[model samples]
Target: MRFRGLLLGLFLLPAVVGAYLLAGSATEDGTPRCDGIIEEYGDAERSGPMKPGETCDLYDFADGRSQGTRSYDQQRKAQEAKASKDGLVGGVCLVYGLAGACAVIAGRRAAPAPPGSRRRPETAPRSRRGGQAPPIGSMSTRTGVPHTRSTS
Candidate 1:
């Protein structure tokens, strides 16, 4: 039982650590940093593939004026989404991991029953509605009545 609990705790430890790391990346404001929209200037036909490390002059819709390079303003929306997803998964992992560890610890402390003895005494079977039936052990099958046993 102790070994089983230890194994369960070890298995869930990774999930707890992973969830902690993921949760760290989550934003408090819940606002996306990048929209990933590339704005095209006048004359779409004349526009060509922007070179690497090259800055394109573009209009800023938020600022209501034409401003700096498009490369700098370009949003990594995909990356942000991935981060958010990872954080959520991590949080879930952390919860399950901690819960599993607790369960393991609790299980390790419980006592095992002795051999050749039932854990609990058998009782009358329950009905479909959850009501207890008459005790089968003391009842007579032929007469459908309880047998009396006297101790004097």
Candidate 2:
């Protein structure tokens, strides 16, 4: 039983881990090299009151700018989302895995009966002797009747 459970876990664990890993990778600010950008990048805390930084920029752009924010760090949200997504995937996989395991177990446990196997009758036993039990017919009291009649 434990071995089967382990196998099921093996089948589902990677998918769950992948979901978490991927969910954590979506980021608002990313690392991009811009050869044309003269602006420097600095940490929010390191830069003082007159802080200046460039998240992203390219040589050609009508807007000539990228997004900026006073406070924008998605590390916590990303981690939480990753963990939840992983847990969700794990849960779903677990359900299907458990179902498969149950089906396999039931199939293994049920044994097919051999040929000529007889089920017990619901009613009491009856006389197996063929032919009429006795004969009956209209006759005088002196003549003992022996007429044909159905047994069943």
Candidate 3:
């Protein structure tokens, strides 16, 4: 049974590792780079905490940068989720498969005896007087009861 369990574990080990590798491979990020710039307020008047008639170039560089960043983040999160799910699946298969295999092996090896098959030899019934049983067909030592053979 132990040998069988070992063999089963060895067989499942490769599958478990393969599952992990596949999950890792599935998490590759492919988002494009953010290079373009948006000029939302070109030479526009400055509004806050500045002298009157002040002008500034309020270029919105972050808008274009955030697009690629957001996409990359979303893809990264999706990849992580998929990797986690696959890892969980692989772990469950590894643990439960090995445990179930071991249990089945042990069950088969320790199967119960068939009906009417004697597992142990029958023994003489003990006396209630708390000593060795009296001989067959003899009276009890203390209670004076006659001993009889059991029908079981």
Candidate 4:
């Protein structure tokens, strides 16, 4: 039984170690897909082919500007509509955010703090000696001495 268990473990060790070694190095390559728009592939027009290191990005006139790879022939109209809608929605969100920020600034400047609401409180001073604040103990651990707090 012991030898059988040993043999099983030895067989599994390489697989386990290999899995660990591979787990740390796995990465995804994000390549923009060109599909649906063009069924048959053909050479790009006089615009020339994209450079070796270059990526494609379709232009969005409504969105103002964009940078990335884009396809014209195979590209669908829906993508354009979606991109425009996304930009409009993003603009609205930015306007709301700016309004909220302005409101916060105006409120801080115009509104007064509530009456008698203390903002800062005095803090206790630290002892110059770098040691634990002596415990308020009644009986000393080393000697049987009673500790007391002076009121006078």
Candidate 5:
């Protein structure tokens, strides 16, 4: 039992560790670059955040900048999705690890019987002839009636 518990713990340890790492990453700030800028490029010079030195001459009426960028809501939603996924995986791993540890501890503990405790005899009860049990439906010599097996 102890060996089996050890094996179980070893196998499930990775899952627990992975969940912790994922949850930790999810908790960090995930804000993206160029959040407030709302400039739709006419010629579509840039599709994402560009370097400060990069020249994008396309006129954007919204933010007056040519570089295209994601809105704040989009970045926030993506972060939330990642966080939720990580949280779910971490929760499952935590629960499984705890249950497995409990099982291992329980298996290692021995039953609390005293050293001199009396135990029930293992030998089967002997009939008058000191032989094996009679077959079912056999008539008893003393009763002399067909052995109608008791339902109870």
Candidate 6:
């Protein structure tokens, strides 16, 4: 059983690493963007207003002018959804890694002796007379038993 656990842990190690890598790859950049229509006010000296659904920095909307738009709400929801997904993936990977570590540690522990293979230490039999007891089937008997011939 211990050997089996060791093998299982070894096999799971590679899988856990692979899973962690995969999760890492799926993660998005830490940049938060506006998913709604960005309406930027600019004069002839600057570029025109941002197009619909264009990525915009959250700082641009810090003035609170566009906070009530549907685009802002959509951006917030998207960010929240991504955060939840990332958290879940990280949690799963952590749990898997912990389980694999436990399995390896448990497998390394000493195995128990097989049934009937253990030997008990030899001990002398107990006697009421405080001496070694007689051999089995001897004429001498225990005090509790009545002898066929009476001492009288």
Record all residue pairs in model 1 with backbone atoms less than 3 Å apart, i.e. clashing.
19-90
lDDT of 1 by residue, 1-152 (tens): 56786688695886767666675666423332322233445443222344344344545668767564445324234445677877877877777777877777676678575577677866654332365444445665567677564578
Give candidate 6's whole-model lDDT: 0.55
lDDT of 5 at 126: 34
Per-residue CA lDDT of model 2 for 34-103, tens digit only, reads: 3333334443222222222432223344665644322212323443565567666655655665566566
Worst 10 residues of 6 by lDDT: 43-52
Query: lDDT of all the models against the reference?
Result: 0.57, 0.45, 0.54, 0.45, 0.58, 0.55
Which candidate would rank higher by TM-score, 3 or 5? 5
**Model 6: CA > 4 A from native:** 1-39, 43-70, 111-152
Q: What is the lDDT of candidate 1?
A: 0.57
Off by over 4 Å in 5: 11-15, 18-26, 33-70, 111-152
Error of 5 at 149 (Å): 32
| Candidate that beats the other on TM-score, 1 or 5, i.e. the better one | 5
Error of 3 at 133 (Å): 4.3
| lDDT, residue 28, model 1 | 27
Q: Estimate each model's TM-score.
A: 0.39, 0.32, 0.34, 0.31, 0.40, 0.35
Worst 10 residues of 4 by lDDT: 24-33
Alpha-carbon deviation at 25 in model 6, angstroms: 16
Ranking by TM-score: 5, 1, 6, 3, 2, 4
lDDT of 4 by residue, 32-63 (tens): 23321222235542233333333345445567
The weakest ten consecutive residues by lDDT in model 1 span 28-37
For model 1, the superposed segments whose C-alpha errors exceed 4 Å read: 27-75, 113-152
lDDT for residue 73 in candidate 5, whole number 0-100: 59
Question: Model 3, range 23-109, lDDT digits (tens) per residue?
Answer: 664654443222332222564332222222322233346563333322334434555676667767776665665576576667767
Model 3 has an lDDT value of: 0.54
